[model samples]
Target: MSCCSPEGHCSSAETAAVPAPGTTTVYTVTGMTCGHCEKAVGTAVSALDGVTAVQVDVTAGLVTVVSTADPDDARVRDAVEDAGYELAGRATAAAH
Candidate 1:
């Protein structure tokens, strides 16, 4: 069953079945000076294939993404780059 039903609600049956683990990835996004920058980073990351969700903390300069597909550092980096930001090294464990 799909993770979310057509109505955009998660069904009990779907919830009962353990979903694949989602990997948490963090990226140091540079050149983000304001909320817009954060939004841009989030939008770019969320647009990636297999990206389930994205959260950004501007103060921390951190961008986190949850995805079922194996987190590709290069892909994440590219996404940040495409958004006009520079991506630091691979995410840290604690951030994940």
Candidate 2:
């Protein structure tokens, strides 16, 4: 599924790259349904200090992120869970 907003813009859902010094990792996420879920997931992920950008696809049931700090799957998973969702699996970076 695509991640475009209503204003005719291509969404970052399928993939995204945060070019900050310490924010360049990707993760796979699960258990998202509507935009609210996406917002929750994004909020949880973005709260981390090193996290710079987050992309979520409710239809695809995935979440991708880029962070400056070392990949912290646990924290990421915890954040997702905190947002009332499940992580489904480990999040490995495609560029890590």
- Winner by TM-score: 1
What would the per-residue lDDT of candidate 2 be over residues 1-96, giving only the tens digit for each residue?
434457646433333444455545555566665666778788888898778788776766767676766667888889989998888764454422
Task: Name the regions of candidate 2 deviating beyond 4 angstroms.
Answer: 1-23, 91-96
Write one digit per residue (lDDT tens) for candidate 1, span 1-96. 333446665321111122345976667776765656766787898899988888777666778777986688899999999988899876577754
Report the Cα lDDT for candidate 2: 0.69
Give the whole-model CA lDDT for all candidates, comma-separated: 0.71, 0.69
Cα RMSD of all models vs. native, in order, equals 11.0, 5.7
Checking candidate 2 for backbone clashes, the offending pairs are 3-11, 22-67, 22-68, 23-67, 23-68, 29-63
Work out candidate 2's RMSD over C-alphas.
Answer: 5.7
Error of 1 at 45 (Å): 0.6
Candidate 1: where is the Cα deviation over 4 Å? 1-21, 94-96
